[model samples]
Target chain A: MSTAKISLRGVHKAFGANSVLNGIDMDIAEGTVVSLIGPSGSGKSTLLRCINLLEPIDDGEILLDGIDISLPGFDANPVRRRIGMVFQNFNLFPHMSVEDNITLSPVRTLGVNKSLARAKAVELLERFGLADKVNAFPDQLSGGQQQRVAIIRALAIEPEVLLLDEITSSLDPELVGEVLDVVRELKTSGMTLVLATHEMGFARDISDLVCVLYSGHIIEQGLPSQVFSAPQSERAQQFLERIIRAGRL
Target chain B: MGTITGRRAAYERARKRRSTVVATVSSLAVVTAIVVLVPKMPRWDRVHESFFNGERFAHSLPRLLDAFVLDIKIFAWSMPAIVVLALLVAITRNSRSAALFPLRILTIAYTDIMRGVPIILWIYLIGFGVPGLGIERPWNSPLIWGSVALVLTYASYIAEVFRAGIESVHESQRAAARSLGLSSWQTMRHVVLPQAIRRVIPPLMNDMVSLQKDVALVSLIGPIEILRQAGIDKSKFANFTPYIAAAAIFLLITIPLTRTTDWLIERERRRTTGTRIS
Candidate 1:
């Protein structure tokens, strides 16, 4: 698959002996969508965070384009600049307008000029159907709109890969579809995507590879259709059973 | 329906006017009673001959006011320095970098020592000790020393206020900024300080009120500010009216500032909580 845009080898992380990612190993091919599905506290979010270098790994290597990124003393800013992360809680800068929130990193860290950054912000806002809300403060928007703004803000950085951490889980039941629609569009445009999510239906429909994590271990991973139909491990089967009982699958 | 609503509005306006009239009359009566009764008392005969003498008030007004300008000058000179120093100290203390550990300890010690002793003591120590040491130029001028003492004294208090503001910003904001590839300093300058500084304005203004009054303390160092001028007048005329006049001028300056700060605090509370006052 043209060598992988990014690869994780022996990624281990823990918070004071409560291990989160225990010797994780995976490789993400370019332009492919990978989904990490598991029960809560099963290390899905932590793994995504480690990939972005938001959380430091205890031991292992995360190589972006065959260059080791997770090594200690490697400045994470350059690597982080190429990886965009959308948090679950929106985390839109409350003090800034929607346009400013989208353009801040581009202008500040990227050295993009004011006029171009603003133009890019305007174009993205229009693409997301948020043109009317450009000057609006984040507190003035709904949970769904805020989340969309966050995703668009991440997109503004022009990152090589996008990481989303439960982007739709915080939205209202009716508001969830709008955010997912944006993700679907991203996939159709051949953007590489990794997400930790609770949406089993969406995961099955979109992901190229689905990894089932359980208690800090990736016990099962393969094509979504195969894993959904036939989970090999007892824990994965039980996890899927819970999803079924909850009517989420 | 229009007539009824218009009539209700008129009635509300009338009621408000009546309440205002009642408040005005009550206040005027209090003033009028003091004016009439105090003059009638025997003590007024003695007090007025000395203190309320129109001629003395007229004579002292310009002289005392001229000296008061030095206090204003000291306050003006010290304000910008105080703000900049407080931000520096607060940032130093709050930094997570191990390289700043010594600076953090120093900042903590500065705040602790400056806050523990009375502000007057700092003024005394700096204003008296520095010049007594026979230092040159800025350190030697009592005027400069008084200003330096005020800035040092007030910056410590203001630094604590700033630290509280910085800490009050949610940790998630920092996380979000860093996730976007903003460095630690960039995140602080953009995402954190703007919000924190806004949150702190009311408290900072509260400290400003304290500062405005404390500028009077510089009089002890021999700058011939309002209080010192008043002291001279008291000794010359054998009356306490100069003290009262000095206090009145201080109230004129500080009371409005204190009131404005109170209003700002209320507005800040409403804005932060996303509430409407109506």
Candidate 2:
């Protein structure tokens, strides 16, 4: 518990009249992978965004490295530097070259030297098998390649926690494997990842813990095996049954 | 199969030839009608002598061209000033800082006032009213004040253009930048402004074409730019050809510029994806 990389306590978030996240609590330990799987609009993305401080929660305490980052007027930049997010839409900067996109945050935010940042970018691109695309713009790359580069861009900042929000949901069926492969690689590297995903099989294979959310509540969470094989909550059972029927589980 | 392909190619060629012939014949008929029928009007000689007199055209061309250099200089200096001021105002208006709320209001007021007033009235007020303040020589010159009026007026219009460009950038782009730990200002400078400026170049160029022609407006206050010089020539020669010569020079520059703007707009349209007409 002391080593929990991210801790959310009694979190609640609402947009105007519709509540998205409600009275939720979770602790993600260091160097473990957690997957949040739920129906669309079930607060998975909202929970991830709250942890990253992209959206301010209506009421909660989000602790990152033992600091309450959800406090009023908390400077989120330094916090965000330690937590990376990969979006559902693969929001890569279209005007920038792949290499530049990866190097920008490190150079601008971290004050890393330009040449060193670029060298690191090249190494990361090479590791991702995107060495030849270092100078290509995002529009020139396929959806899979762009997502891979986005992962590389997130990695360049060397974040302690990575929050991925349905990163593979937008890719073509044939292209989803490439990005999932990168996630699998990350899982083996001991990075703490919190993913909101629809890829049930991949989530089951990689996640140490699986959380089932319904109606903005984490109805069940436990070891992936326990959650997948025997969901305790009725809502979790119904949700998993639908996923099973879709051949996703 | 080869015979079928050859026949298709021949058919395509015939269609192209037919369209080209029709276009050329229609254009020629319009030109011939204007050429033959226009002079048949009773006062054609008077109209031609006043407007298209060969001697006056040649006589006024050199002086008008010389005066036009002044117009070019005014346009050149005013454009950069307008661009810089407009960008600042646009960014100020777009800022989300609570501390900058006053600045945002100021920018809104500035743009509203500048745009609400007619450019001519501004030229008169700043051009005459400022000098009437008993300012010293050189600084009091109408050219300096007149150029300032043009800059202020045009910057307001251009600022809105820039603001439109800024707003057009997707909010997700800003979120992505912010999530990367870049400060809001850094996000704007690197991620937003570059894209915004690129998107607005076509409209910005259109504004510049208008700005170029409106440089002639300064002649109303003073500074013997082409239009003013044309007046001088007309009074001296007692003919209106100088005005026509001045117009020709403006058309020579503006037409090409207008065409270039269209080309850029077309190229930009082709580069992006979305709903497109066939």
Model 1 lDDT per residue over A1-249, tens place = 238988988989999979899988888999999999999999999999999898889988998998889988799887888999999998998888888899999999999998999999999989989999888888878899999999999999999999999999889999999999999999999999999999999999999999999888899999999999999999999999999999998
lDDT of 2 by residue, B81-166 (tens): 99999999999999999999999999999999999999999999999999999999988999999999999999999999999999
Residues B1-278, candidate 1: write the lDDT tens digits: 99999999999999999999999999999999998898899787888877766666666778899999988998998999999999999989889999999999999999999889898898889988989987887559878888888898799999999999999999878878888899989999999998899888978987898888788898887888998998898888887778778888888988888788788777755543433555
The regions of model 1 sitting more than 4 angstroms off are B1-55, B258-278
Q: Chain A TM-scores, one per candidate?
A: 0.98, 0.98
Question: How does model 1 fare in lDDT?
Answer: 0.90
lDDT, candidates in the order shown: 0.90, 0.93
Pairs clashing within candidate 2: none
Interface RMSD after interface superposition, each candidate: 2.1, 3.1
Q: Which candidate has the highest DockQ of all? A: 2
